[model samples]
Target: MADPNWLDERELTAWKQFLSTGAAINRLVDQQLKRDAGLSHQQYEVLARLAEAPEGRLRMTDLAGAAVTSKSGLTYQVGQLEKAGLVRRCGCAGDERGIVAALTEAGWQKLREAAPEHAALVRDLFVDGMSRKDFAAFAAGLAALHDRLNPPAI
Candidate 1:
């Protein structure tokens, strides 16, 4: 076999730091959202995606994609949101069997109420902690890595 490629010292350090920081950040956000909005980060993400879609609605698949969640996970989250009166499911406009998730008025209100604190948390933990130039470079690098790791289909 050809020589195996592996992470060098710097790459290994970056990888570990990236994973730990991401995990810590996710936990912090989830804790805040749970305490304030009774929502998980993923649930908030689902609602946020639906909120931005045309007419505050999106097909189930589209919402899942936008939220970067699996279909089953999205289904469960949507069900939870539905029970809370934050969202409603309906038959898709073009396909009877296809489901759509639509944000309710309550959902809009919840998002609005939760947004300011959520944004502040993100800025405090991530954005504002870095110099503007550093933040920009970090974001650009992560975007490139993310795109490479999850390339678009033809």
Candidate 2:
């Protein structure tokens, strides 16, 4: 009988592939962003999320959540962006204690410059490398995993 505690050969291979592939992709993305825009992957994510938000702004807490980073981490990244003149911090209108991060024109330009190369890299490394059927299945699997990890709040 097979041991329930151990992954079978196929399962082990899949698990190892997932970890190594994800790490490789992350490293490549970080390197590409840093080389092309002088931005780290986390900073790029923050800028992209802000750009997608209404009025190109979001409360710090909301930004942290959207960026999948801790509040402190988001704050530090925002501070760095502020220093670069790419983002600004302002008090939220309705909530005195709420701090909002707004993307500056510079931020928009940076994101614009970074996006094309980023998208092309993603397509080259991930999308074009897989068949449509396989890609769809992989996407579905990832979506399911995401949903499982982040269930809706009551």
Candidate 3:
């Protein structure tokens, strides 16, 4: 009884393909955003989250978690966005220690402008590139993986 956990050729190929494709998708999406919208993918994510939040605002801490960025990185991004007139930061209501990022009107407009093109690029680069049947299977597999490993918090 030594080790039974080992990936065969198929498993190894699948793993490598997932890693490379995921990175490539991110890179292409980022490039498109930068070229078409003058925004980076991370910046787009920050703006998107803010735009969807109630009153287009979210706490910095909450945003950091949602955007999956470190505190310092979020701070830096927010500052950059502020300079670009895409977002504004303010003191959180009733919380001296809390800061909130709010989507500016300009930011909302920018998002509206960028969304269609970004979506098209995503569809062309990712969705359209996969067969519908394969897409469904991949989606199912991902959902199962997520559900098993990261179930919702009670």
Q: Clash number for every model?
A: 0, 0, 0
Could you give candidate 2's per-residue lDDT for residues 1-154 as a string of tens digits?
8866989899999999999998998899999999999999999999999999999999999999899999999999999999999999999998999999999999999999999999999898888889999999999999999999999879
Better of 1 and 3 by lDDT: 1
Total residue pair clashes for candidate 2? 0
lDDT of 3 by residue, 105-140 (tens): 999999999999998998998788889999999889
Best-to-worst lDDT order: 2, 1, 3
Off by over 4 Å in 1: none
TM-score of predicted model 2? 0.93
What TM-score would candidate 3 get against the native? 0.90
Off by over 4 Å in 3: 1-4
Q: Tens digit of lDDT per residue, candidate 1, span 44-123?
A: 99889998899999999989889999999999999999999999999997797899999999999999999999999999
Question: Model 3 — which ten-residue stretch has the worst lDDT?
Answer: 144-153
Evaluate all candidate structures by whole-model CA lDDT and list the values in order.
0.95, 0.95, 0.92
**C-alpha TM-scores of all predictions:** 0.95, 0.93, 0.90
Cα lDDT over the full model 3: 0.92
**lDDT, candidate 3, residue 48?**
88
Clashing pairs in 1: none
